[model samples]
Target: MGLLLSGVLVWQASNAAFVGVTSNANNSWSAGTVNLTNDSGGTPMFHVTQMVPGQSGSRCIEITSASSVPVDVKFYTDVTALPVDDIRPYIDITVEDGTGGTFASCAGFTPSGGTEFTGTLQNLTTTRTTYANGLGPWALDGTPPDKLSFRISWQFHADAPPVAQAGSTPNVAFIWEAQS
Candidate 1:
Protein backbone atom coordinates (compact mmCIF):
# COMPACT_ATOMS: atom_id res chain seq x y z
CA MET A 1 0.00 0.00 0.00
CA GLY A 2 2.86 2.37 0.87
CA LEU A 3 4.63 1.65 -2.42
CA LEU A 4 1.43 2.31 -4.34
CA LEU A 5 0.91 5.62 -2.49
CA SER A 6 4.54 6.74 -3.19
CA GLY A 7 4.21 5.90 -6.87
CA VAL A 8 1.01 7.91 -7.11
CA LEU A 9 2.66 10.94 -5.43
CA VAL A 10 5.67 10.76 -7.86
CA TRP A 11 3.36 10.61 -10.86
CA GLN A 12 1.31 13.59 -9.63
CA ALA A 13 4.50 15.68 -8.99
CA SER A 14 6.00 14.87 -12.41
CA ASN A 15 2.77 15.91 -14.23
CA ALA A 16 2.27 19.12 -12.18
CA ALA A 17 5.70 20.73 -13.04
CA PHE A 18 6.09 23.10 -16.05
CA VAL A 19 9.07 23.29 -18.48
CA GLY A 20 10.50 26.09 -20.67
CA VAL A 21 13.23 26.18 -23.38
CA THR A 22 14.86 28.98 -25.36
CA SER A 23 18.00 29.42 -27.53
CA ASN A 24 19.85 32.06 -29.55
CA ALA A 25 21.27 31.04 -32.96
CA ASN A 26 23.80 32.28 -35.49
CA ASN A 27 25.90 34.58 -33.27
CA SER A 28 28.75 36.17 -35.21
CA TRP A 29 30.89 39.31 -35.72
CA SER A 30 32.86 41.12 -38.45
CA ALA A 31 35.46 43.89 -38.73
CA GLY A 32 35.38 47.20 -40.52
CA THR A 33 37.96 48.31 -43.13
CA VAL A 34 39.65 51.43 -44.52
CA ASN A 35 40.31 51.76 -48.24
CA LEU A 36 41.91 54.74 -49.96
CA THR A 37 42.09 55.65 -53.64
CA ASN A 38 42.83 58.57 -55.90
CA ASP A 39 41.76 60.00 -59.27
CA SER A 40 45.19 59.67 -60.85
CA GLY A 41 44.32 56.35 -62.57
CA GLY A 42 47.92 55.12 -62.14
CA THR A 43 49.30 58.15 -63.97
CA PRO A 44 52.03 60.51 -62.83
CA MET A 45 50.80 63.89 -61.65
CA PHE A 46 53.46 66.00 -63.39
CA HIS A 47 55.81 65.21 -66.26
CA VAL A 48 57.61 68.31 -67.46
CA THR A 49 60.52 68.22 -69.87
CA GLN A 50 63.47 70.61 -69.37
CA MET A 51 62.20 72.35 -66.23
CA VAL A 52 64.40 75.47 -66.05
CA PRO A 53 65.01 77.81 -63.15
CA GLY A 54 62.23 80.35 -62.50
CA GLN A 55 59.79 78.09 -64.36
CA SER A 56 56.57 77.23 -62.55
CA GLY A 57 53.69 74.76 -62.89
CA SER A 58 50.87 73.27 -60.85
CA ARG A 59 48.84 70.05 -60.74
CA CYS A 60 45.83 68.88 -58.80
CA ILE A 61 44.92 65.44 -57.52
CA GLU A 62 41.90 64.33 -55.56
CA ILE A 63 42.06 61.63 -52.89
CA THR A 64 39.22 59.78 -51.22
CA SER A 65 38.59 57.22 -48.50
CA ALA A 66 36.06 54.43 -48.78
CA SER A 67 36.18 53.12 -45.27
CA SER A 68 33.59 51.56 -43.02
CA VAL A 69 35.31 53.14 -40.02
CA PRO A 70 36.58 56.62 -39.15
CA VAL A 71 40.05 57.44 -40.47
CA ASP A 72 42.80 60.02 -40.79
CA VAL A 73 44.33 60.99 -44.13
CA LYS A 74 47.78 62.40 -44.86
CA PHE A 75 50.14 63.09 -47.77
CA TYR A 76 53.92 62.99 -47.95
CA THR A 77 56.96 62.36 -50.11
CA ASP A 78 58.63 58.99 -50.15
CA VAL A 79 62.12 57.58 -50.75
CA THR A 80 63.04 59.66 -53.79
CA ALA A 81 66.52 58.13 -54.18
CA LEU A 82 68.33 61.46 -54.39
CA PRO A 83 71.63 61.43 -56.23
CA VAL A 84 74.81 63.23 -55.17
CA ASP A 85 73.79 66.56 -56.77
CA ASP A 86 70.19 66.62 -55.54
CA ILE A 87 68.53 69.98 -56.28
CA ARG A 88 65.67 69.84 -53.83
CA PRO A 89 66.51 73.07 -52.02
CA TYR A 90 66.21 75.32 -55.09
CA ILE A 91 62.64 74.17 -55.74
CA ASP A 92 59.81 75.96 -54.00
CA ILE A 93 56.49 74.17 -53.53
CA THR A 94 53.11 75.48 -52.49
CA VAL A 95 50.52 72.94 -51.35
CA GLU A 96 46.85 73.79 -51.04
CA ASP A 97 43.96 71.60 -50.05
CA GLY A 98 40.30 72.05 -50.95
CA THR A 99 37.86 70.32 -53.30
CA GLY A 100 37.11 69.60 -56.97
CA GLY A 101 40.02 68.46 -59.11
CA THR A 102 41.67 65.49 -60.80
CA PHE A 103 45.15 64.25 -61.65
CA ALA A 104 44.65 65.19 -65.30
CA SER A 105 43.23 68.66 -64.62
CA CYS A 106 42.54 71.32 -62.03
CA ALA A 107 39.58 72.81 -63.86
CA GLY A 108 37.08 72.98 -61.01
CA PHE A 109 39.70 73.07 -58.26
CA THR A 110 39.15 75.67 -55.57
CA PRO A 111 41.54 76.71 -52.79
CA SER A 112 40.08 76.88 -49.31
CA GLY A 113 41.51 77.26 -45.80
CA GLY A 114 45.16 78.08 -45.23
CA THR A 115 47.88 76.79 -47.52
CA GLU A 116 48.84 73.29 -46.56
CA PHE A 117 52.51 74.09 -47.09
CA THR A 118 54.59 76.90 -48.64
CA GLY A 119 58.33 76.38 -48.64
CA THR A 120 61.27 74.77 -50.39
CA LEU A 121 61.15 71.07 -51.15
CA GLN A 122 64.08 70.56 -48.78
CA ASN A 123 62.17 72.14 -45.92
CA LEU A 124 59.06 70.13 -46.71
CA THR A 125 61.03 66.88 -46.83
CA THR A 126 62.58 67.56 -43.44
CA THR A 127 59.47 68.84 -41.67
CA ARG A 128 56.89 66.48 -43.12
CA THR A 129 58.78 63.21 -43.10
CA THR A 130 56.08 60.69 -42.16
CA TYR A 131 52.39 60.40 -41.45
CA ALA A 132 53.11 61.38 -37.85
CA ASN A 133 54.38 64.75 -39.13
CA GLY A 134 52.93 64.68 -42.59
CA LEU A 135 50.83 67.41 -44.22
CA GLY A 136 47.51 66.51 -42.61
CA PRO A 137 45.68 64.12 -40.35
CA TRP A 138 42.25 65.05 -41.71
CA ALA A 139 40.07 63.37 -39.12
CA LEU A 140 37.15 61.92 -41.04
CA ASP A 141 34.24 59.72 -40.13
CA GLY A 142 34.66 58.08 -43.57
CA THR A 143 31.07 58.92 -44.48
CA PRO A 144 29.27 61.12 -46.97
CA PRO A 145 32.17 60.57 -49.34
CA ASP A 146 35.41 61.70 -47.75
CA LYS A 147 37.31 63.63 -50.40
CA LEU A 148 39.94 66.37 -50.75
CA SER A 149 41.99 67.85 -53.56
CA PHE A 150 45.64 68.81 -53.22
CA ARG A 151 47.25 71.33 -55.53
CA ILE A 152 51.04 71.17 -55.64
CA SER A 153 52.49 74.25 -57.31
CA TRP A 154 56.22 74.32 -57.86
CA GLN A 155 58.67 77.02 -58.90
CA PHE A 156 62.34 76.49 -59.63
CA HIS A 157 64.17 79.28 -57.78
CA ALA A 158 65.46 81.96 -60.13
CA ASP A 159 68.68 82.11 -58.10
CA ALA A 160 69.48 78.44 -58.39
CA PRO A 161 73.25 77.76 -58.22
CA PRO A 162 75.33 76.88 -61.25
CA VAL A 163 75.72 73.30 -59.93
CA ALA A 164 71.99 72.81 -60.40
CA GLN A 165 71.94 74.45 -63.84
CA ALA A 166 71.87 71.17 -65.80
CA GLY A 167 71.47 68.71 -62.95
CA SER A 168 68.17 66.88 -62.79
CA THR A 169 66.16 66.80 -59.62
CA PRO A 170 65.54 63.42 -58.03
CA ASN A 171 62.37 61.66 -59.04
CA VAL A 172 59.79 62.25 -56.33
CA ALA A 173 56.78 60.20 -55.36
CA PHE A 174 53.81 61.68 -53.55
CA ILE A 175 51.99 59.25 -51.33
CA TRP A 176 48.60 59.37 -49.62
CA GLU A 177 47.64 57.23 -46.67
CA ALA A 178 44.40 56.77 -44.73
CA GLN A 179 44.45 55.11 -41.31
CA SER A 180 41.86 54.30 -38.72
Candidate 2:
Protein backbone atom coordinates (compact mmCIF):
# COMPACT_ATOMS: atom_id res chain seq x y z
CA MET A 1 0.00 0.00 0.00
CA GLY A 2 1.06 3.61 -0.77
CA LEU A 3 0.32 7.03 0.84
CA LEU A 4 -0.91 9.78 -1.47
CA LEU A 5 -1.96 12.90 0.48
CA SER A 6 -0.59 16.36 -0.28
CA GLY A 7 -1.70 19.76 1.17
CA VAL A 8 -0.31 22.98 -0.69
CA LEU A 9 2.58 23.62 -3.11
CA VAL A 10 5.02 26.58 -2.73
CA TRP A 11 7.78 27.97 -5.07
CA GLN A 12 10.55 30.55 -4.44
CA ALA A 13 13.27 32.12 -6.66
CA SER A 14 16.83 33.04 -5.48
CA ASN A 15 17.86 36.72 -5.54
CA ALA A 16 21.28 38.17 -6.52
CA ALA A 17 22.85 41.07 -4.58
CA PHE A 18 24.93 43.88 -6.22
CA VAL A 19 27.37 46.42 -4.69
CA GLY A 20 29.25 49.47 -5.97
CA VAL A 21 31.99 51.79 -4.48
CA THR A 22 34.18 54.70 -5.52
CA SER A 23 37.07 56.71 -4.04
CA ASN A 24 39.43 59.65 -4.75
CA ALA A 25 43.12 59.57 -3.67
CA ASN A 26 46.23 61.67 -3.53
CA ASN A 27 44.70 65.06 -2.70
CA SER A 28 47.06 68.00 -2.11
CA TRP A 29 47.33 71.79 -2.07
CA SER A 30 49.91 74.37 -3.09
CA ALA A 31 50.50 78.14 -3.23
CA GLY A 32 51.23 80.06 -6.39
CA THR A 33 53.84 82.77 -6.97
CA VAL A 34 53.98 86.28 -8.44
CA ASN A 35 56.88 87.19 -10.71
CA LEU A 36 57.48 90.21 -12.89
CA THR A 37 60.06 91.14 -15.50
CA ASN A 38 60.67 93.94 -17.93
CA ASP A 39 62.05 94.33 -21.43
CA SER A 40 64.52 97.02 -20.30
CA GLY A 41 67.31 94.43 -20.07
CA GLY A 42 69.21 96.27 -17.34
CA THR A 43 69.20 99.53 -19.22
CA PRO A 44 68.24 102.86 -17.76
CA MET A 45 65.10 104.31 -19.29
CA PHE A 46 66.74 107.65 -19.75
CA HIS A 47 70.23 109.09 -19.27
CA VAL A 48 70.41 112.65 -20.42
CA THR A 49 73.83 114.22 -20.54
CA GLN A 50 72.39 117.69 -20.79
CA MET A 51 68.76 118.79 -20.39
CA VAL A 52 68.32 122.40 -21.41
CA PRO A 53 65.30 124.54 -20.70
CA GLY A 54 62.22 123.55 -22.70
CA GLN A 55 63.88 120.18 -23.40
CA SER A 56 61.60 117.20 -23.64
CA GLY A 57 61.83 113.45 -24.19
CA SER A 58 59.85 110.29 -23.74
CA ARG A 59 60.52 106.58 -23.19
CA CYS A 60 58.51 103.38 -23.35
CA ILE A 61 58.98 100.22 -21.30
CA GLU A 62 57.20 96.90 -21.46
CA ILE A 63 56.47 95.03 -18.23
CA THR A 64 55.79 91.30 -18.18
CA SER A 65 54.39 89.21 -15.37
CA ALA A 66 55.02 85.47 -15.00
CA SER A 67 52.60 85.09 -12.14
CA SER A 68 50.90 81.78 -11.54
CA VAL A 69 47.79 83.67 -10.50
CA PRO A 70 45.92 86.82 -11.39
CA VAL A 71 47.32 90.06 -10.07
CA ASP A 72 47.18 93.85 -10.15
CA VAL A 73 50.33 95.79 -10.99
CA LYS A 74 51.07 99.18 -9.47
CA PHE A 75 53.57 101.78 -10.68
CA TYR A 76 55.69 103.91 -8.37
CA THR A 77 58.91 105.87 -8.24
CA ASP A 78 62.18 105.61 -6.34
CA VAL A 79 64.12 108.84 -6.37
CA THR A 80 67.82 108.19 -6.24
CA ALA A 81 68.92 111.67 -5.16
CA LEU A 82 67.67 115.18 -5.17
CA PRO A 83 69.08 117.47 -7.80
CA VAL A 84 71.78 119.95 -6.87
CA ASP A 85 69.44 122.90 -7.44
CA ASP A 86 66.14 121.23 -6.60
CA ILE A 87 65.19 121.24 -10.27
CA ARG A 88 62.48 118.62 -9.73
CA PRO A 89 59.94 121.40 -9.47
CA TYR A 90 60.85 122.60 -12.94
CA ILE A 91 60.59 119.17 -14.53
CA ASP A 92 57.26 117.88 -15.72
CA ILE A 93 56.34 114.19 -15.94
CA THR A 94 53.63 112.55 -18.00
CA VAL A 95 53.15 108.80 -17.62
CA GLU A 96 51.02 106.67 -19.93
CA ASP A 97 50.28 103.01 -20.56
CA GLY A 98 50.10 101.20 -23.89
CA THR A 99 52.03 98.88 -26.25
CA GLY A 100 54.70 98.85 -29.00
CA GLY A 101 57.64 100.55 -27.33
CA THR A 102 60.96 99.95 -25.65
CA PHE A 103 63.42 101.41 -23.16
CA ALA A 104 65.19 103.29 -25.89
CA SER A 105 62.25 105.14 -27.37
CA CYS A 106 58.50 105.72 -27.40
CA ALA A 107 58.16 106.12 -31.14
CA GLY A 108 55.57 103.42 -31.60
CA PHE A 109 53.85 103.77 -28.25
CA THR A 110 50.15 104.09 -28.86
CA PRO A 111 47.84 105.71 -26.34
CA SER A 112 45.77 102.66 -25.55
CA GLY A 113 45.96 102.07 -21.85
CA GLY A 114 45.35 105.73 -21.04
CA THR A 115 47.38 108.25 -19.07
CA GLU A 116 48.56 107.22 -15.64
CA PHE A 117 50.05 110.39 -14.26
CA THR A 118 50.35 114.01 -15.25
CA GLY A 119 52.34 116.18 -12.87
CA THR A 120 55.79 117.37 -11.91
CA LEU A 121 58.68 115.14 -10.94
CA GLN A 122 58.57 116.62 -7.48
CA ASN A 123 54.96 115.60 -7.01
CA LEU A 124 55.72 112.12 -8.26
CA THR A 125 58.29 111.62 -5.52
CA THR A 126 56.33 113.31 -2.81
CA THR A 127 52.73 112.34 -3.50
CA ARG A 128 52.83 109.21 -5.64
CA THR A 129 55.77 107.63 -3.86
CA THR A 130 54.14 104.40 -2.72
CA TYR A 131 52.00 101.63 -4.13
CA ALA A 132 48.91 103.01 -2.42
CA ASN A 133 49.23 106.21 -4.41
CA GLY A 134 51.01 104.62 -7.35
CA LEU A 135 50.00 105.26 -10.93
CA GLY A 136 48.43 101.96 -11.85
CA PRO A 137 46.75 98.80 -10.69
CA TRP A 138 46.95 97.31 -14.17
CA ALA A 139 45.18 94.01 -14.25
CA LEU A 140 47.08 90.94 -15.51
CA ASP A 141 45.52 87.57 -16.25
CA GLY A 142 48.43 85.51 -14.85
CA THR A 143 49.53 84.35 -18.28
CA PRO A 144 53.21 83.67 -18.83
CA PRO A 145 53.81 86.83 -20.82
CA ASP A 146 51.15 89.10 -19.41
CA LYS A 147 52.52 92.38 -20.68
CA LEU A 148 51.85 96.08 -20.03
CA SER A 149 53.69 99.01 -21.51
CA PHE A 150 54.37 102.39 -19.95
CA ARG A 151 55.42 105.61 -21.62
CA ILE A 152 57.14 108.24 -19.55
CA SER A 153 57.40 111.71 -21.01
CA TRP A 154 59.25 114.51 -19.33
CA GLN A 155 59.81 118.16 -20.03
CA PHE A 156 61.62 121.09 -18.55
CA HIS A 157 59.46 124.15 -18.14
CA ALA A 158 60.14 126.93 -20.60
CA ASP A 159 58.32 129.78 -18.92
CA ALA A 160 60.52 130.01 -15.85
CA PRO A 161 62.21 132.75 -13.93
CA PRO A 162 65.49 132.19 -15.80
CA VAL A 163 66.65 129.83 -13.07
CA ALA A 164 69.70 127.95 -14.21
CA GLN A 165 69.63 124.20 -13.72
CA ALA A 166 73.13 123.46 -14.90
CA GLY A 167 74.63 120.24 -13.56
CA SER A 168 71.38 119.54 -11.73
CA THR A 169 70.98 115.78 -11.99
CA PRO A 170 67.95 114.09 -10.52
CA ASN A 171 67.49 110.36 -10.92
CA VAL A 172 64.17 108.61 -10.51
CA ALA A 173 63.60 104.87 -10.72
CA PHE A 174 60.24 103.63 -11.95
CA ILE A 175 58.90 100.57 -10.19
CA TRP A 176 56.07 98.09 -10.72
CA GLU A 177 54.45 96.02 -7.99
CA ALA A 178 52.19 93.03 -8.61
CA GLN A 179 49.69 91.76 -6.06
CA SER A 180 46.70 89.52 -5.92
User: What TM-score does candidate 1 get on C-alpha atoms?
Assistant: 0.83
Question: Taking the tens digit of each residue's C-alpha lDDT, what string does model 1 give over 78-159?
Answer: 6567778777898899999988888888999998888989999888876887888888877879684788898999999998
TM-score, one value per model: 0.83, 0.81
User: Root-mean-square deviation of each candidate, in angstroms?
Assistant: 3.5, 8.2
Please list the residue runs of candidate 2 whose C-alpha ends up more than 4 Å from where it truly belongs after superposition: 1-23, 167-169
Q: In candidate 1, how many Å is residue 147 off?
A: 1.6
Per-residue alpha-carbon lDDT of candidate 2 for residues 1-180, written as tens digits (9 for 90 to 100)? 123222212111223355578999999999988999998998888787677778998888989899999999999988876766777787799999888787767678787856778998889888877888887788988877888888888998886446654646467788899998
Question: At residue 48, what lDDT does model 2 achieve?
Answer: 76
Q: lDDT, candidate 2, residue 65?
A: 92
